[model samples]
Target chain A: MQQVFGNKKAIAVFVLPTLILFIVVGFLPIVQSVYYSLLEWDGFGKGKFVGFALYQDLFVNDTYGIKFLNSVWNTFYLAILSVCVQLPFAFFLAHVLARGIKGEKFYRTFFFIPVTISSAVIGLLFLSVLNPNYGVLNIVLDQLGLGSWKHDWLTEDKTALSSIFLPAVWQWVGYYMLLMYAAIKGISEDLFEAAKIDGASGWRMTFSIVIPLIAPIIKVCVIFAVIGSLKFFDLTFIMTNGAPQPATDVPSTLMYNAIFRRNMYGYGSVMAVFMVLECLLVYFALQRLFRSREEEVAR
Target chain B: MISALRTKWSNVVLQFFLIAFAVVQLYPLVWLVLTSFKTNLEITGSNVIGLPSKWMFENYKYVWVGSDLARNFANSLWYTAITVVASGLLASMVSYAVTRMKWKLSKLVLLIIMSGLMIPVHATLLPLFIILRDVHLLNTPWALIVPYTVNAIPTAMFILVGFFSALPRELEEASVVDGCSIYQVFFRIMLPLVKPALVSISIFTFLSAWNELMFANTFINKSSLMTITVAINSLRGLHTTEYGPIAAGMVIATLPTILMYIFLSDKVQKSIVAGAIKG
Candidate 1:
């Protein structure tokens, strides 16, 4: 068995299919995108090579009227909300629920339901609920005498991007909660017992013991949230499709519009390449940031 | 005495808060189901939260027959089934080779596969579209299936690697000493050992493929070839004022996932947690 398994041919036979598929369907596209980004083509009948002009136009010049910089900034705004607001709220719920509360299974299942369903479904659900005239949100607000606060959530430029975050947070809070909850649950009971015997209060135990121990998982959740937000397209696509003049445009949706709608394939590939690089850079930067903080804590 | 009393009061308050949050989390789904049963007049009327005075079960029938939902549902089912099986088998095989077999480039191979996780779908969309168009696979189910399987390889391999590595080596050694071929050892002996992991990863893969929208939206242009996600999205444009049919469409699109959660919630939750920490 060792001889057969260790044979070079056997290894190639086992691994080559996956590797080749990954390269073709997964890796090759990005390489092709990078290559395409350098050329000037409209996705068909193209043979011109104008190197770096597309990238220059994307950043310095607004020749294409793509709003590329604004889309990047919008993506950053969503990523910040994901890390700052979404994950913390998820962490709070996880910390509370990890206390071995009753109906744990029920609550966990319910919380995660949104995570499992299609984002388009969630987007439509909220779109209907937040509709200005007969939507439930405005109706509820009117009954509570806060009708003045109600606005057209997904249409108006000011509220469209922020309004989408409500559904985004609603969709993913359970996901991060489950992650943190699992990490917290892995902490041994003996530590809590030891702290209790040492007369540590509940808040102290949470602050000094639980939070510190789950710091690594917290970092993982943050990375997930940030990366997920940066590439977010489905909900916004369903809700607004970057309507009302690109107010809710993220890089992914913008890339889609450039490629499919406007037939600007080269420009779209530029956005795609930017997104790939941004994800990698953000991931590495986060790893470094988390590692430095861990070292400081150790010191 | 005062502290204990305070603890009890706080627990009550905490429970109230959690329940309220849960209500907020679940109310939209409940409203969706209720609205699916309401008339268009009821939905757009002033009575927002009231129960339907007369149930409109025909909303479901109309949406089902009026759109390509039934065909899209079949497409989604087959696409997910093929993707889960193909990706699972291929990932497990690679993971098995890397972990159990002797190979010098195993670590490099693993790293390459793992890096696939960071490549966003947006980055690959145009090139893939061009390739599929060139291959005449655009507007075909193969377009979705190929990408789905390829993209799922990393996560499936990530999960399977842990399970494959943790299996005791003694069993493999004994199987070898008994004159079993590598294939026999893998197929007859090792495959059954990782059944639980396979099931968990399959569930994850199924859910991902089921909920996927972008690729389905881009690759398959024909209404008949559309997936449930794209089909439901088209409903938004088709029946803008008809909330009842739209709600019914959502319920249809969401039912499979809801059922999976009901039956396999624990496995699903555990696998998700494991994948997150391990990945």
Candidate 2:
């Protein structure tokens, strides 16, 4: 203990700056936000203290109630849909590429390029491409004699959600696929050669041998996917601006709107607090579920 | 013979399906590049997928001269480079001490640094804004650069720590014995060994800092201080629209990033695939 404590000077010199910066810039806001949740501050005025009433109203009021519910739904939508839509294809493609499939590098780059672009840019690009009349998608439909398939994808209620969801899936499928590909390569090659000699077919081999061996990575990917799902913004905000009413609002957008646009600092803080808590809940739930699944598979 | 042909046909079908999915993924980007050449009216008119009848490179011309996008791009570039260097070195220093030095407080410091990862950027915005304001950093480069470097420390440290942990102890010990102080050992011996991890963290740090919107939106006020993402978003007012210059601005904002990704494409693929396990 004494010997460990002897290096206090070295430790303090290394750690103090980041610690101090995080304390002032990060932690204090969380504490202040909780405190602000009890007050009525419109960003810049002296106001009365309103304790927990804001919380009660945010939870119970019918006007904001549906919006809040929709926000939660949007979170779940991105989390669940993206994982389901992206993972199966990403895993197979990754497996093929990792095993030195033809043109592997080009395929990987094509998929992963979207991940590098800002979500804001992707949102804008898609908005133009999905424009009801002049958009490229509609043009494609016309060329193919399937004009009926075309719609104002972003603005119309029937297609707005899918429009945003599809773009998110498109931009990121490569990113996750790359991660999966890496994990696949890391798996020992001797195992695969052994499986081939045992007369196991490729399809069965992938499901049982490959999937179970890389389960840990897939678990981490899901956790990362879940958090990303719940907190996504940029696309919905810039693409539609919660347009056609509250059709595409997520919690982050709602929190941002409440704080900046509506000038409801206290109310916004409550939403912000809930968002943090909601993320934790989803994260742990997935972790527990996956961890147990691993144990079950092991047993 | 008929059955054999059927089996061969099935393999081709499966391969084609994978190729089709890859095509769909790459299309939106192809769309982005093509639309940048079309006129505003042309883009907004019929035939979203049709070929541009007349390519007006004017969009690029208008976006470059008409707005503050060029300045914003420069700001993002400057911030990304400065933050990557500052935070990268700072993280390496901290990781060196924590992993090599015999200190109880170093572990505590490591824990605090790691915790910064889970603290959402939004949660930090308000307090950080006030802190920047207090320091007279509002609308200044300090607001963007300082907050960015501070935010990047955790991930930089985490990667570097993981790197330094996996290093053999004998080399570091030999450096210490060769009349090298801790600082010399860190710089001369330990630093050169962790190049891959450092590059990986640096790319991620630079990318996040360059592309972030909320923090830039909240803390920065001067139009001069705007980033590429922020300036592009602000082009249109609440009522009036300016799609032409906006798309142009979007393309300009995109070029640097595309260039960086292209040049470092192999490095990025290597970085992420290397299984950077922590933040």
Candidate 3:
């Protein structure tokens, strides 16, 4: 025991692989992104230290500043809309499915199918399906009496970003449901029986009993959702390509296009740095708020 | 009795709603498979709504060759293999070291490792690019391999540490008394035991690398070197967009994941359940 107790070298050996990778890839890049933010470089061109000049470019100029605003707004807008819609729907639907409600296995498997499919595939399918003239959606609307509701969803500035949200929500809801449902399922059945004896209706039982118990899980779920949405990339990129002339841009797409296309790597790094801060702020704030709320509830 | 019948009818209605949802969940993938058989003119002129008239396996063949998805799959397979083995081993090691062993300094080490999960790549892409450039790892497999492995540590370590901590330590201590080294105790003992955790780590790493994009998109600019997701995204740009080849490529791309899911559905479901279990 004494021999093993002081074996720091062996312990370090065990820890070395991951720790080194963390430093090389994870830790260093963060410090480097901030450093790069202070310079002017076009990747191939020489970098000049401008001392926060790129930030000046970000705020003073309409070009970068406005694009950043559109991106941030779209990201959070999608996040808010997703939480409001997906959570309650997944919660209730999970409750319904969890009740040994016939075809239970089928329903569970059914919802989870989309999750195995990648966001890229979902984006591709929607891009094709939401085609303005010949798409399935517009065609169905034209068949109905509400032909006036027909509009170009993906290409329109007003609807493009929001248009991608449905597909994102569709792919994700089941994944979250599986999380929430699994949580609800783990709750003891005696509670449900007790609620029934108290004359609680199904909806009431769900609201009072299941909701409170799963609140912690839901908090984590919402955190995952919000942080994920804040940094969302692939689906938006593929689906809209920031179409309708930059109206649909999210921060990631902005960061990507800035770096890849224009080669304005320095200004792009500033935007990237801000994105990191925004996520940290949102995450810490949510966590702090949730912690306090839990304490209050306990009291 | 009437109320009982009404309740049964409502349950049936709910079942029907769920079945319809299952179909809607499936419709796009169904279309992709069916349309792979359709001709270019068939896809373009006809609505992308239904089954194909003829079964054509050639779309798969053409895409495998023409779009170079076979090469992309090869790249993805290697990426998945390295990431799963290397990351899983490293994460499992740290998990054992921190969780089971009594080390005062390990408390901080564990916290640092777990907190790494909060670091999203978009936050650090610029810096990562510079670091990779400085090391000349840009456009190399090392660029993808190192970062993907690092990014996975927290989640995989979190899962494994929970699992290892829950393990009864009596057997391990007995092995220690029998003059077994830690390596043998882990390999001859705990390694075989944590099969499920290993599976969980491997599958998670496989899926993560298999679906990885942002880094690959930024780093690997070479045509032959792109991973499948990047390859698929670039497929449209590499040539004219032909529905057959695109559908074929998607089919090829999707098969490995589907096969893995089919074989490991129970294990995968268990992992998700385990995720919910701890929370």
Candidate with best DockQ: 1
Between candidates 2 and 3, which one is better according to lDDT? Answer: 3
| Candidate 3 segments exceeding 4 Å error | A63-66, A143-147, B273-279
* Positional deviation of residue B52's Cα in model 2 after best superposition, in angstroms: 4.1
**lDDT tens string, model 1, A61-129?**
978786888988887898899888998889888988887887776787899889999998998889889
The lDDT values for all models are: 0.89, 0.77, 0.79
RMSD of 1: 1.2
Q: Taking the candidates one at a time, how many backbone clashes does each contain?
A: 0, 5, 0
Candidate 1 vs 3: which has more lDDT? 1
Chain B alone, TM-score of each model?
0.97, 0.91, 0.95
lDDT at B23, model 1: 99
**What is the per-residue lDDT of model 2 for residues A73-160, given as tens digits with 9 covering 90 to 100?**
8779888887887787788788888877657788788778888888788888887778776777788888899988878787787778
Winner of 1 and 2 under lDDT: 1
Query: Can you write out model 1's per-residue Cα lDDT over B124-149, one digit (the tens) per residue?
Result: 99999999999999999999999999
Give the TM-score (0 to 1) of chain B in model 3.
0.95
Q: What is the TM-score of each candidate against the true structure?
A: 0.98, 0.93, 0.95
* Model 3, span A191-227: residue lDDT tens: 9999999999978987888888888888878887898
Candidate 2: segments with Cα more than 4 A from true spot? A1-7, A62-66, B1-11, B46-55, B238-244, B274-276
